[model samples]
Target: MMKGFSPTKYILKSFKSGKEFKDEGWTLDAPGEMEPSLIRAIYDKKQIDVKDDSWGLYKFADWLPIGRVLEGSSAPVTYKSEGLAKELGLENLWITFSGYWPEKGTNMSTCSFKETEAYSVCGRMTPEMDKVLVVASAGNTSRAFAKVCSENNIPLLICVPEDNIGALWFEEPINDCVKLICSKSGSDYFDAIHLSNIVAGMEGFVAEGGAKNVARRDGMATTTLSAVTTIGRIPDYYFQAIGSGTGAIAAWEANLRLIEDGRFGSNKMKLMISQNLPFKPIHDAWKADSRHMLPLDDDLARKQVEEIIAKVLSNRKPPYPIAGGLYDALKDAGGDVLLASNEHAHDAARMFLELEGNDIHPASAIATATLIDAAKSGLVKKDDLIMLNITGGGEEKFKTENELFYLKPEIVFDINPGEDEVIERVAKLF
Candidate 1:
């Protein structure tokens, strides 16, 4: 039997590589990077300091370890989608699948990495203050956080685009303890983000500042840590779908810590990040080899991306231009970026299911497409260790529940409506 949980080793000790920066906030001290630090600070018995207390919350979870593959295997390795890799020339790769439909018999729950983030973020919260935690999601994140908050009885105010509310798993409503807010016109994820900031300005509520939250970053970083621990080292490359590119950033951070532990692999992992086609500003920028990208003015392009086969990976303003952004991470890591069309994503998904017999999420298929492109272009070596992050899957599980997750239509307003009118509508929620 396994021994009692060890928080020290899993969290406190592992965060030793943490550092703080003025502009970039707290970050891990990744090797060969120009950023300040990965971790802000650490808190332990008998002492507390400013650097460590930069963020209000300071707890961590010993999340589940990296899953193992089935050689002669037992228990059918949950989240291990074998067919997905072979279809993309990743025969000897590991799929760090998150989101819905874990092989462990859990149906597609909230359908996001938010579950992983919430488990770790909430583990850091305390009962001293009634934290009205605010989170914005296109769909999956709100659901994931709502489920975690409901089970933990954590007060939460979730914000999402009205049009995207239809994407939420309506079968599981936000817990009664959690309040929901929908942006006007069902704008995009950015609209919900703006709404979240407005809500955060209110009393008793705090915004879980997307990628800025250390808990959120580290929580997602667990994916990389799990992969390293399980595979016993960092791979030659890391591929994942990104909205904010936070997961990629997390992997960069975690790899640094693993290096410090001196037991994991080198700090030489390549980052291969991808965006959905039609509206991929980041991919376009990466391809152009430019530091910045102009926002797409093409309505058709935006529509195609918004209505993409893999809508979850779409982001209007990813953190690609900021300091220590996706571009920098990839450049420093000697990485490559790619864009996958809806057809490519769809075909990849189908191919993966047929070959590996695992139904991968559409976003994951985009990453799978990139892997194929890498193989054909000779960007990947035959024997190089690779880790493909299956961001989300298990859409079929939603059908079994026989119900749709929907949100109540809240107030609707213009894109940047009058602040007074917005404040009044928000005041009603409290």
Candidate 2:
């Protein structure tokens, strides 16, 4: 552990039962049978003080549930927007960027905000813990975690859909401590998750816990912290594109923390989260005002997932309906789910490049598309304080400056492989 960094700075609290416990490697459940809920990090510090001496996201270490700061990490960049704000006719618009833009001092090498989760989750691991950490992702997330664990020499096993294997490209060769696996071709994010769950059950491997991990959520929450700290107040509206809606929920959680801090004004920002059209499960559920997601046909869901341009936003089983999840966050934060068509998203991507001078991920494009609609339709007033979260960007720029190396899967499995076969095969990789 790093000097002066306390593992006891925060306690894990159940969002449903309000029970608190100490960090015990990978604890995702409460003491007994109860309603399903996310466990949260309740930090000891009520007012967050940015650490000037710390690097990257560690500057916000007061709230992040990390024992040690990792090298090569960077904080999200927040700046008052001049170009996109002018184009949208909004007066108080702030943009928080989470990807590579060395000019702005943002350096997430994977070109995705998922780096935030990777850094914190990996940081939470102690040297005493020798278990292999398992992660399941569609694309961007696997890339981020792979990059971080490879650099840090942390043992990691990554499972991603074979269709998204293209996203595994990196600037440098990955270390052998990190291993890659994939679900069969034509599989979706959920299939990748299924494979990961099977691996996590085996001995010597541990699940990364997805949205259930407080460290992951608190890491992603730094975007909101960056925005609010930079803007000096919480914006009236917060916009982002969601895959699992984890980041949006992170924003809402950060909003609650800021309100408690008593420095930033006590106002909850409306989370105007968007999903790509034809694959908007969260949007569909929100529209129907249902806590539980409406039944979606498996074949139709897989087909819809393939149709969306923003492939990273294709989580079939998002944490929307669970306690202390997206549904509850949306209700508390006063927001509505929005959808963005492929045409509009592409146009928005082009507009951002032309106006903002940066290439963004397709998911970020979908978020910008929704913001444009909201501005034009008077959902936001001309002077309303707004923060648009550019979840990922600068991939084109990064690629131009660096040679790319794609990671190859050591093992591949069908969507629903036999558990014993999986365990036997995956165990050999180590």
Q: Which candidate ranks first by lDDT, i.e. highest?
A: 2
* Runs of candidate 2 exceeding 4 Å displacement: 1-8
- Candidate 1: TM-score? 0.80
Cα RMSD to native, each candidate? 7.6, 1.2
Candidate 1 C-alpha error for residue 365, in Å: 1.5
Query: TM-score of each candidate?
Result: 0.80, 0.98
* Cα lDDT listed for each candidate: 0.63, 0.92
**Model 1 RMSD, rounded to 1 decimal:** 7.6
Could you tell me the lDDT of residue 399 within candidate 2? 97
- The TM-score of candidate 2 is 0.98
Worst 10-residue stretch by lDDT in candidate 2?
1-10
Please give, for residues 164-199, the per-residue lDDT of candidate 1 as tens digits: 776656455556677777776536777777777887
